[model samples]
Target: MKKTLLFNILFYFVIISFLYSAGETSFNFLKISQGARQSGLGEAFTGVADDVNAIYWNPAGLAQLTRQQVCLLHSVWLVDVNYEYLAYAIPVIGVGTFGIYGTFLAGHITITDENPVTGQYIITDDIARASDINITLAYAKKLSEIVGDNSVFSDMYAGLNINITMENIYEDTGNGFGTNLGILYYPRYQNYSFGLMILNAGIASERPTLPFAIKLGFGYRFSFENILSPFTDEGYYKFSENDSALAIDLIYYPIEQTTKANFGAEKYWNLNKFHSVAVRLGYKFGSDLGLLAGLTVGAGYRLTLNENFQFDFDYAFVPYGDLGESHRISITGKMFGPAETNYFENKEEAVKYYKEGYELLYNKKYAEAILKFSESLKRYKNYAQAYMGMGACFLRLGKKETAKKVYELALQNDPNNQKLKEFIESTKWDIK
Candidate 1:
C-alpha cells in the first residue's frame, strides 16, 4: 500500500512539471548555486549529497546523517552582487531528518530616468535596493521504514522541501511559494550514489512561473585500499582515507528549454586522522555568458577538533569571461566524529594505532605511547586494549594515581576482563 502511494506521488509530480508555464519564470535567483563545495564541483552535488549542503542540493541526502550539522556560505558574484546561504540538518533517531535552507541575495542598482529636453539618461537621487530571499523547510526518510525490511531497500531515500521566496526591486515586491522533491540511493558501502530532483515546482501570485528545473546526477569514488588490495590488509588502509571521486550531473531548465551537463573530479589526501585536504576541478559543457564554459578550481580543509566537534572550510574560484571572477567560501561545523558514522572501518584503523602504541610502550617511549593510545581511543571509544595501554604509559611515567584511575575506567567498560581486575586489585593503595 505504501509503495502504491509513493508511485502515485512520483507519477503526478513528473506530469505536472511539463504543464507549468515556461520561458517567463520570475525569481530566477532560485537557480543560483548555493554551496561552496558544490560550486567548486561544477554545481554537480545533487548525487554526492553527504553533508549539510544536501539541504539545498537534494534533501534526500539528509536521511544519511548520523548527527547534526550547520553550514554557512558566502560568495561575491559578478558585478555588484553578493549572496549568503545557510543550511542546517538534524537527525531524529527513528523518524527521519529535518533541514532548514536559506538564501539571501543583495545587489546594488542605480535609479535612472530620461530627460525630455535633451533625450538623455540621467541618474536620479533615489535609493534603489534589489534583493531576494528564500527560506525552505525540508524532511527526509529512508524507504526501509515503510517496507519493514532494510535488506533490500535500505539505500533508497526520499525528501521534500517547502519554499517561501520573496523578491524586492525598488518599489516593486513579489512573494511566492514552491517545492522541491528529490530521491537518492546510496548503499552502505559508500562507493557510489545516484540522485534525482525536481526544483521550484510551484506557482507565484504575481509571476507566471518560477525557475523550474530537473536534475539527475551520478557519482563514484575509488579508494586506495580497494584498488591496491594486493599490498593492503583485508583491502582496508590502516593510516587514513585517500581516494578519488568523480561526479556527473545533467540539468534541464524548463523555463529556458535548455539542457546542460557538468563534470567534476576531486583528489583527497588524509595526512592523519585529525586533518585532511582535497583539490577539485570542475567544468560545465556549454556556452556561458557568451563564452565557452570554463574550468573551476577549488580546495578544502577539514580538522577534527575532538571527539564531538569537526570543522570544515571550502573555497571555490570560478571565472566568467569578461564578467570577471567569482569567489565562494564556506564553513561547516559537524557535531560528531567519523567514528560515529563509519563504525567498522574506524575499528580497523583503531587497532593499527593500538599496535603502534604497544610497540612504543615496549621501547620505553611513554609520551609517544600515550599519544598513539589516545589516537586509537578516539577512533574506537570502547577499545579496552587501548585504554590498558594508556594506563601502562602513565604508570611508567610515575603517575601512579592517574594510572589507577585509567585502569578503573577500563574496568567499568570491560568488567569481565580478568587483567583489568587484577591490575586494580594490585594498585589498591594507588587508587585510594
Candidate 2:
C-alpha cells in the first residue's frame, strides 16, 4: 500500500479521535538536539550553559549570556535519518530577554517491489518521509526589583516558552500547542542558582491530550576566591583552600510515563590568571538501570581577550565502553560592545596556534596530534575541523575502538561528515 502525506493527516485524526482520545500523544523527537557540539556532551546542559543553546536546555540560562546569539544544529540520527534545529537569543533592552527555537526531523525509506498479474516482476518506488517540527518564542525577565528591591531574593527571575508543534508521517499527522514555563533563582552572581520548568503542557489538535512534564535543576559555584579568602584576606573565616560546584536535575514526563534525574558536580582550579581547568562528572537515573552511569569529563579554558573580543575553548570526553571514547570541542567568541576596551590585540597569533594544531594532525603523529587537537579545542571548542582532526588521529593510532567512538561523537557536532561515516564502516563498526 502506498501512503501519502494526506493519508497521514487523516490517519492521525482517526487515531486521535478514536484511540487514547484524552491526552496528547507522545512526541519523542522533540527531545533530540540537532547541534554537533552540544550532543557530544551527553546533552547535559541542564546546568552548565554559556550560550543561547540554553533555550532548549533551560530558557532561564539566557539571562546569563551577554551577547545576542544565534546557533544552528544538524543531526543525523541512526540509520539514514536527519534533523535540524535553529535557535536565537536576543537581549531586549528594558524587557530583559527573548528567544526563538525551531526544529525539524525527517528522512527515512522503505522499499517495495511490484508484482504484475500476468507479466514479469517490476520494481516500484515506495519511499516514505516523516517529519516533525516545533517553533517556540521565549521571554524571561528579572523579577527581583518587582517583587521587592529590599528583599534578599530580589534578583530572582521567571520565563516562559510558547511552542507550536506539528508532525507528519507517511500516513499520520498531528499538531499541538504547548508552553514551557520556568522560574530561575540566582542568589548571587555565579554563586548559587536554581530553576523549575514545566514543559509541553498544552492541548493537542485532534483531541484534548496533553504531554505534561516538569523539570527542576539547581546549581552552585564554589570559587577560588571563596576558598582563598580564609587563608589571605580573612583568616578569621577559618577554612581550607578547595572549591567545587554541584547540580541536580529531575524531570518527569507524564505522556511517556517516564522520570529522569541527574546529579552532577565539578571541581575547578585556576592554573593562572588566563588559564583554568575543571573535572566534571555526573550520574543519571530514571527508566532503566543499565542506562545509568557516570556521565563524562569536560574541561574548559578562557584563552585570550581584547577590547572588543574574547575567546573561549571547551573540551569534553564521552566514554561508551571499555574500548570506546568520544571527544568534543567548542570555541566561543564574545564581542564586547563598542564602549568596551580590547583585552588582546593579536588575532594572528590565535590563528597561528590553531593552524599549527592542524599541521600536527596532518603529519600522522597520532599521539602528538591528539594533544595538539586537545590544545586547539581548548582554545576554540566550536571548530568542526578540530573535532575531525581528533577523530582522525584516534583512528590512525590503531585505536579503531576509540576511532569509532570518536567518529560517532564528531557526528553529534557535525553529523554530515561522510568521512566519519566511512571511518566507522571501514573499522567494522555497526553504526546502526
lDDT of 1 by residue, 15-35 (tens): 223222233677777767777
- The C-alpha RMSD of each candidate to the native structure, in angstroms, is 14.2, 20.8
Maximum-lDDT candidate? 1
lDDT per model vs. reference: 0.76, 0.58
391: Cα error in model 1, Å: 36
Instruction: State the lDDT at 359 in candidate 2.
Output: 86
Q: Pick the candidate with the highest TM-score.
A: 1
Error of 1 at 313 (Å): 0.7
> Which lDDT tens digits does candidate 2 get at residues 1-432?
332233332333333322222234545555554333344444545554436666776777666655666665544433344566777777665667788989876654544333445444333466666777889888776675366755865756667788888887766678888877777776531355678777777777753454577888776655545655434412211223335667777777676676777666666666765555656665555422134323655666654454345454556564433323335455545555321111223334435555776788777666776665555544444455656676777666665555665556566667787876776666664335
